[model samples]
Target: MRGTEPPVTPDGRYIVVRGRLWRKANPALDAEARQTLVADLMKARRAVRDAVRIRDDMSLRQARRSVNDAKVALGERGPVWWTDGAPDLNRRLARNTIYAEWYAALPEQP
Candidate 1:
């Protein structure tokens, strides 16, 4: 899993990894909504962990869906937040994109 707090671009609108851009969470999300979604996300994550420990495949599948739903609600998935038409690269491996060289050259985040 990626860190809960990913590094944001200097402008705070995008996540910056190896100089590549990924749209950040929706700024339009109000505080209460954000909190609720985050809580749901955490709950789902805990469910996933529990399911894994118990080796319950059905529970794991359901928990994974919940996690994805929460992420979508939180604007971490789905449509691009920016109007520039940049491809959504959330959860993508750096080596798969055009910025692979740049990503490889940059030092790992501390």
Candidate 2:
């Protein structure tokens, strides 16, 4: 996600990663809010890793839930943040969704 520039849709709704679409955080969110959510998401992800390493089912579940909550709050999951009613293409292959034409035009893709 760092070495090469990830291609984000023109609408700014999703970023293509490994040929799959992942929802972007809500652009409407203020910088501080977005930063805080991102921080929480990272912490939760670390917790998930630790739980898995320790073989703690309860902690794993809690960590996963926290991660989900942070993602939703960041507008990366749950309800669509946009008002246009476009169906979510998250986790879908870029070649199979409405972004196919755009993705095909890219100079490089996964």
Candidate 3:
């Protein structure tokens, strides 16, 4: 997560961060569409932080929903975007899954 770009899986389905697998945004999305979604996502994330700071339960819920919606639209959550029948592995530690060998071989990040 500290790097400009995390190490992505060989198949491009996920990016490895802090030894965990996170689903990537859909590659099929056009640049404009992806940019727009990412903007909305960042806005929602800021709202989440603000809500937590102020202890506003209602705003927190709404902001979280916005975050979830953006993530879904970005193909990072809810359902698998790939058609290859692979199981969703979002949030799994890379060392515990099929990517263990590959993950082990990556150069250590500072």
TM-score to true structure, per model: 0.69, 0.96, 0.95
After superposition, candidate 2 runs with Cα above 4 Å error: none
lDDT of 2 by residue, 6-95 (tens): 999989999988889999999999999999999999999999999999999999999999999999999999999999989998999999
In TM-score terms, which candidate is top? Answer: 2
Clashing pairs in 2: none
Better candidate number, 1 or 2, judged by lDDT: 2
- What's the true lDDT of residue 109 in model 2? 62
Model 3 earns a TM-score of 0.95
RMSD of 1: 4.2
Candidate 3 contains a number of clashing pairs equal to 0
Q: Residue 45 in candidate 1 has what lDDT?
A: 100
